[model samples]
Target chain A: MYDEPYRWIEAVANRRQYLDDQFIHGSPLVGISCAQGVLLLTFNRGTEKIYEIYDRIALGGMGHPADLEKLRFTLLDMAHVEGFQRSPSDVTASRLLKNGLAPVIKPAFEEIMRAPYIVKILLVELGTSQDRDHLFTMDYDGMFAEQREFGVLSASSSSGDRLSAEWKSFGVVASLSSALEIGLRLWGVASLLQDSSTSPEVKIEEKDKPSSTSPSETPEEAEVTTRIREMLANETLECVLLDRESGKMETYRSLGQSDLQPLIPTEFQPAT
Target chain B: MGQQGDFLQVLGEQGYDVERVFSSHKVDALHASGMVTTGTTVLAMKYRDGVLVAGDRRATAGNVVMYDRTDKVLELDRYSILAIAGVPATAFEMARILEHSFKYYRRSQLQDLSFEGKLRALSTLLKNNAPAALSGTGTVVPIFAGYDLHDTCGKIFFYDILGAEFEAVEYAVSGSGSSTIRGIMFYLNRWSQRTMVELDEEEALTLVLRLMTSAAEFDSATGGIDTQAQLYPIVKGISAEGVRSIPVERLSQLFSEKVVNHV
Candidate 1:
């Protein structure tokens, strides 16, 4: 029905609205760069949401599992081919997103006849130094941004902003445990933001909110912590690290439950 | 991709040919000159803890030494090692492919490639290079060793130029100096007080150094320890924990104290 130019624009806008609705209940992911390396943490129902794409590159995403898997394989292929043709160090998050995934994703999204990918991905590349670490977030519509220190992918832009603000106050942590704690705390905030029916278009002024740097949690943070505790009983906490100090060819490793046990906040631990 | 966890298949689809890349004009020129760069004398044996793999630091071209600091034993992943005894160019390329393939399979499938799968992967590469191998241009006879996490023990497998894999119960040897090392190993295993499996880490390392010395005495291609330059063989251990390289410092101390004085 999108025979006219205006109709095609309207169709694309409608597709965006439909995608937003599908992502209303999407799980949130937090990727933080620290001295240890980069930690990507997400609370998922079962299937893995974090992956190692290359030696130094990792991926975390929220959306349709099928779409996510497709995107993951595409990235894996591109990264390996690039690494083989050129060099392993040549594979970077910026290059993969800008030159590889973005171009592929943008077209499917614009083509009304083709099924657009229902996914949002955060790609992290561990640099030689902590400050040099690169993170990129790609949207379903093929929009992406290069970030430093932290990257967040959530249901709504507002929730992403809330998580970003929370992460900024905490800053890049030095240890995996400390970074994990911050990631969990940000996950809670993202849950609160996604749970609330507030319009993402409405920007809540940061000054109006309680100072996030305060030691105590906001009321919403407390509620989300309880929510997380209950959800943890059945859901699995997936965390993968691109460890700079691994000193091995492949640096990606998924954290085991035992590894995460002590680091998990007492308030959020699921009953064994 | 269709969930094909085969990295070489992925590479093949992208037009990668190990034989074509290896058997080129440079190789032809080298063949005409009778100087093909070859790596020599790689061996692996079971020890008390796990497996110890060693390779002498030499790359040869006919009678001339092409390079002295060549590392023939390559770590394919955390647990797996590839020790080649063939054309250095072809062997190095195989190692690189294997390194990428293991990581690619693990990342794509979200699980480590099984021990049997790892073995087959190597066989497949060798089989694909049959043309080059049969032509005497890029023949690679390799010994593979790794800690089998599932089997809970160290295992060694050796492959012929035609890609036939055979499990070595105690030890395996390859390369130009292999005949001398192989003959000594057969005698030692039969007459020695302790088998190769019963030796401790230090004993295993000492035996390897002695073996290399003996191999070099008989085979010119095997460059034994370069004491003048303080260069020793590359020795790596694979165990239940993982893989670790024996530092040059430790090798030095062991050579000076244990191998030299027979302590």
Candidate 2:
């Protein structure tokens, strides 16, 4: 008798706590850099987490059900339905976000706003337009934050800060590898910080991390430095980008762990 | 709380026990007797760029012909195509639900369903109709094919009456003439020395017409392109571009020049 997505509403409400608990378990990450006619997203295959890859909208999810793959598809279908029934020209990013996306995600949001799932979407446009690409980071409550240039949503803030700085230095129209350079370094830093913080031997307070006066190669830092080199030396990267001339999105995989070695700066790698 | 308080009271008034509707029932072959009108001969295959799906135009009730111009093929979503071959009414309803669900899902998630995901959803719907299938009334099975953005190629899946799914490597067919159609495709693929992926969209369309015609020869229920009725089989293709039905004029030409004159 109930048809307005009420079928799942009751169940979603009952399992609200379970979903929230799962969201706190794993930390998935994505690095995005967009320029005047080009947008690029880099995913970390090293984590083996599920990611929601949909048409026109590829998002990185950090929460329960690792890959919110169905949600991504439903979102695309909603956009298509809005664009269709009316006219094909009606299919635009701005229109989809306003009329298609916002209204659709509202019901699920209201059901369990306290859930810990966080969604970061890189909205790529296939049509030729002068408008810029959009990066939207949404929390469980449907709060939307728009980012320009670059954005990183992860468990660690230090990594975000470092990535932001890299974005600034790379400038607009930076190649995909340049953006990946920033992501790889930040990924190493974040993982090491997490490992060190969780170690029983390290009892330092959060404020004194990477202590300014602690000098460069401490034993803990040395261990982190070694792990980064190993990961970089054997990492296989998966990258997707939106084509400018054809306006088509293409996904490609670059093999070899050392493939990215050239892009990683000397300072980030361990001394040979 | 909204409808919970009224459930027991309502059931009491209606003279029905709570277990009647909610709990499992032990019933045997007691619903509708046999299927009414049924559709036949739905075929789908993966080509180089995208998927090619086609279906016949006839609806049959045992020995009697119920309707012509019945479209058996349906577009499930922007990126997928469905060809139904079961109870005509249930098939139509299933198509409608599928179209709605895929659209609802994409909008809610802001993405297109994966090729495998679409197949799984269709299979779930079929499984849900188990009661109807058992009683022999609402049974529906269809061949699903579509372009997967992830794989960047065409993919096809078929389902049984029980709603179990089977993935087809090269081609798939359902209804009264599946074996006949399957053999024709196999022969052509072997003789022509072209892998399914090597065939262009146009060549794929022609092959589908030829196969449907051969299938119509054996299965009276299967409809071929009828020149007198000016009716053609429903044909559609899916590519990286999207799902689109092949125009009637082109189909008529192909039937006349390729299938009719040659065969």
Candidate 3:
């Protein structure tokens, strides 16, 4: 039906709106670089949203799981084939996005005849040190932006901004434990911000806001922490670390609940 | 043509014709002229804890030593290693293919390729190189050793030039220098008081060093150890924890005290 150029443009706009509606409930993903390495965190019911795409590269998505999986494998196929044809060190986040994912995703998204991919992707590459780390974020429309220390993906731009603002206020984190603390707190803020955007009429349940433990947490952030703790009752946090000090060729490590127990605060721990 | 996890098929789809690439007439001419460099003497044996894999650092073409300090034992992944015994060019390409294959499988499938699957992947690559192997242009008789998570122990598998795979229960050896010590390894494993399985890491390492030394003594292609240059064989241990390279310093100390002094 989108034979005319104007019709095609309108259809594409409609597709964007549809995709936004679909992702209104999408959980936000957080990625940040620390002294130890880089980490990607998200809370989910069970499925994993974080993945290792190569030796130093990782991927986290905040959209349709099936679409994310397909994109993940496509990226994997491209990465591994590129590494095989060229070199492992050549498979950087920028190259993968520029020459690999963007090319494929952009065409699919623009083709009015074909269904578009409704996923937001965050890819990170751990460098030799924290300063050199590369974090990139890709929107549903194939537009991508590169950041040095932090990247986030969510359904709403407001929530994404909230995550970025929270990260900036936290400053540089030297240890992974401290990064995890800040990441989870930002995740909490993003989730609440997304919920508020989706349903402005409804307010977050006013449960007993847990005593703010961190000195940096604002009153609003503390309220978000309590709201997230309630979410932890049914949902679990998934965190993947690309550690620089792992001393192995492969640096991607998934932090399990037991491993995160000590790093996670008491108020945030999911109920057993 | 193969499954989604088939790396060779993936490469094939990308215009990488393994058979053609390996069986090029130019490479055939080089092989006939005896200019194709070949690595020598790689061995793997089961010890009490895991498996010890060792390979001498020598690449030779005809009568000339092309190079030393060649790493024949290549770590393909966290748990697996490939020790090659023939044309380094073809073997190195195969090594790179297998390395990417494992990672590709893991990433696409979301699980590590099973040990048996890994064994077959190599077989498929070797089979694809049949023309090169048959023409004596790119023959690679390699020993594949890894910590099999399902088996909960280190395992060794050897392959012929034609891709036929055989499991070595006690030990496996390949390359030109292997002939010098294969029978001795068989004898020691069979008749010695401490079988290959019973030997500890140090003992296993000492045995491998002695085997390489003996192979070097009789085989000029094997650059077993260079005392002046402090060059030692590359030794890797595969256990449940993963692959760990035995450092050069440890290899040197063992070579002097155990292999050289016969302590």
Best by DockQ: 1
TM-scores for chain A over all candidates: 0.88, 0.59, 0.89
lDDT score of residue A237 within candidate 3: 80
Error of 2 at A101 (Å): 17
Residue B254's lDDT within candidate 3 is: 88
The collision pairs in model 3 are none
Off by over 4 Å in 1: A198-219, A270-272, B22-29
lDDT string for model 2 (A119-151, tens) is 433343433432455556554545556666555
- Model 3 CA lDDT for position B207: 88
lDDT of 3 by residue, B25-108 (tens): 544677757798985999999999999999999999988899998999999999999999998989999999999889888877
- For residue A29, what is the lDDT in candidate 2? 51
Can you give the lDDT of residue B83 in candidate 3? 96
* B68-176 per-residue lDDT for model 2 (tens digits): 8898888877788889887776777667656655654543443555677677767866776766666566667888888888888778888888888888998899988
Candidate 2 residues lying further than 4 Å off, grouped into runs, are A1-272, B1-35
Question: What is candidate 1's TM-score against the reference?
Answer: 0.93
A1-272 per-residue lDDT for model 1 (tens digits): 88899999999999999898888787889998899899999988777899889999999999999999999998998899889878998998889989889988999999999999999999999988898899999999999998768888888675555566677787647688889888888787776676563344323433355465422223366687787787677788899888889888778888989888888777777656
TM-score of chain B of 3: 0.95
